[model samples]
Target: MSKRILITGAAGFLGSHLCDKFIAEGYEVLGMDNLITGDLKNIEHLFGNENFVFHHHDVTNFVHVPGQLDYILHFASPASPIDYLKIPIQTLKVGSLGTHNLLGLAKEKNARILIASTSEVYGDPLVHPQTEEYYGNVNTIGPRGVYDEAKRFQESITMAYHRFHGLETRIVRIFNTYGPRMRLNDGRVIPAFIGQALRGEDLTVFGDGSQTRSFCYVDDQVDGIYRLLLSDYSDPVNIGNPHEITIKDFAEEIIKLTATDQKVIYKPLPKDDPMQRQPNITRAKEILGWEPKVDRAEGMKITYEYFKSLTPEELNKKDHKDFSKHIRK
Candidate 1:
């Protein structure tokens, strides 16, 4: 029988890609998502595939899988700053209660599970180029705390399960990733800048744009996740590109990529936003033999093409949810 795997948040960008990867590898893929921040369009192509099935469910509630499961990729949560800021409570529940539900299901099915973690755990790092050993400098009460804390808690519970229950588990701290099928209005720097350029608007730079980030292409990210899931090691690993760039420089690069004449404009930086975020991937290199393969120029070209293909309406819209009212003072 083909190995079966359940992927939570399967309608999401990364999750949908995982569904595609597993399905292509001849594994039976069961996808579940509440569509809170995820879009059905990401996984719409798989609807007719016999090896792929989907459930419309929230992971915050009890998760029930009916058959023998070989693996679970727990990725259900509000990922972006905009989404989490808008629905902070749900974000907390999905990470805490949702992760607990999935871990329970994994235990019941005897499945190897991997939970999606983020570089946000590092939270304005005092240590440059954060490594797995570095304890992060996160503010538990900040606006962004809802996401960082939830992920930290998820990791804690996952580790406990691994130690006490002896369940097969993996944790991946994903860094900034971008690619095709990204929602143009999701409010990440990639889509945000691309959308602004496409609409002939100025690129908005927060806090003089000196903050730094390292980006990995979606394919590279998925590849790293796949490798980590199958590896023997159980500790947390950082999976992301190490090619660091400043936000100001990134904006200039986007302008060049889009061939737009618009200049950048500065605004007050959001509270608790990280000043630097780059993963130290030595653990990943040694353990999983994974490194990001796509360079920014090549990856940015592909991403730009995808966004350029969107409808004019999609190009014009700010976001599906009007979270402007939720902006913290």
Candidate 2:
């Protein structure tokens, strides 16, 4: 009998990659997604594979999968600021209610569960180079709080399940990750900037562009997550590239890489936006023996090529212009 794993949010950027990884490892992968932020194109290639099956269901509702299961990876939440802000209630619900549903499902199946947490939990840090120990400075009523607090609540309940119910649980704090299959108009920095450049539009820099982010290639993130799922350690572990770069410098780097003459334009920064974000992977290194092998220069080039492969309509879509629609709600 082959191992079986159920992965929610399996159609999203990271989740799709995980589906590929687990299937490659010979696990019968049962993928689920609501398609609110996920696109079918990401996982379309796996449609014909015998080892893969997909469920077009929302994790906020009760999730049911027939038969034995060995693992459940709960990753079904609106991750980007644009999507979450537009659908704030859904974001909060998915992270809180959606996670609760998955936890209950995990208990019923007796499968080990892994929930994807984010670096945003360390919002607008008072401490530099964020560690897992740092309690975040977040405005609960602020706009970004929809996603941040939901994830914080996710971590809380997951720990509760582990302690009270003795359900096996794992949490991974993911940082800035980019690669192919990302929605060009999702409004994340990498895809936004690349979309702008591909469409010959000016790159829009929010604020003075001093905010920093560390980019982890998708492969490295999945590798770390896979290891964390199998590891005995239950506490949250930060899984991301520790190398940090500022928005201003990163914009300049993108311009250089694309060799585009278009200049950057400025926009007002949103509220509660973190000034810095870099993961402290001391635990990941010691435990998983893992660190990102792909550098920004290498990763960005690959990401850029992916953006270039999209249709002109996708590249030039007006939705990428977060103009006033997503301005802190």
Candidate 3:
């Protein structure tokens, strides 16, 4: 029999790519997503494959999977600022409640699990080129705190489970990742700029656009995650490209790539936005023998083509959700 694995957030951008990766490797892949931020269209191509099965359920509730399970990748969360800011409580629940439930499930099945953490944990870092050893600088009560604190709590609980229950766990601190299947209006920088350029609007840059970010192509990010899952190291591993670029320079690159006549526009920076985000990938290279293979220019070209292929409706669509029903007082 083939190895069986469960991946939550399977309909989202990174999760959907993971589903494709494991399925291509001949594993029995179980995909679960609440579809709050995940779109089915991303994973629709896999429905015909006998090796892939999707469960449309929220991980915050009890997760039930029948038969043998070999691995679990806990990736269910509202990742973007637009989504989490709109539904703060749900963001908290998935990282706390959702991670707890998945860890429990992993223990029950004797499966090795991986939890997805993010660079947000290092909010507006005082340290340049963040490392795993560096404790982050974050505002617990700030607007971006909803996502950052939840991920911090996630890493805490995951480690606790590893120590107390002896559950096999892996933690990946992912940096800024971008590619196709990204929601154009999800409030992430890549998609935001691309969408504006496509719509013939001036590219919007917040805070004079000097803030720096490193981009990891989706393929490279997935490769690193796959390598980490199979490795013996259980501590957090940073998976991202280390090549950094400023927002202003990146915007000009996009304008040139798209050949758009629109000029760049500026706005005030959001509260607690990280001014610098470059990953210290020495751990990843030494441990997984991995470093990003795709450069920004090549990766951005592929990503831009994917966005240009979208229909006019999808291009203009905003991913706003009615979270009032899900929000608690």
lDDT of 2 by residue, 57-151 (tens): 98888888999989999888878888887888888888998999989988999999999999999889998888889988988889998899999
Q: How far is candidate 3 from the true structure (C-alpha RMSD, Å)?
A: 0.9
The Cα error of candidate 2 at residue 166, in Å, is 0.7
What is candidate 3's TM-score against the reference? 0.98
lDDT of 3: 0.94
**Candidate 1: global Cα-lDDT?**
0.92
Candidates' C-alpha lDDT:
0.92, 0.90, 0.94
* TM-score of structure candidate 2: 0.96
Instruction: Name the regions of candidate 3 deviating beyond 4 angstroms.
Output: 320-324
Per-candidate TM-scores read 0.97, 0.96, 0.98
Ranking by TM-score: 3, 1, 2
Candidate 1 residue lDDT tens string, 1-329 = 99999999999988999999999889999999988778889999999999999999988888888879999999898888889988898888899999999999999999999999999989999998999988799999999999999999999999999999999999999999999977777869999999999999999999989999999999999999999999998999999999999999999999999998999999999999999988999999999999988999999999999999998988898886665553443
- Among all windows of 10 consecutive residues in model 3, the one with the lowest summed lDDT is 318-327
lDDT per residue as tens, model 3, 1-329: 99999999999999999999999999999999998989899999999999999999999999999999999999899989999998899999999999999999999999999999999999999999999998899999999999999999999999999999999999999999999888788999999999999999999999988999999999999999999999999999999999999999999999999999989999999999999999999999999999999998899999999999999988887664556777788
Task: Please identify which of the two predictions, 1 or 2, would achieve the higher TM-score against the true structure.
Answer: 1
Q: How many residue pairs clash in each candidate?
A: 0, 0, 0
| CA error at residue 327 for candidate 2, angstroms | 17
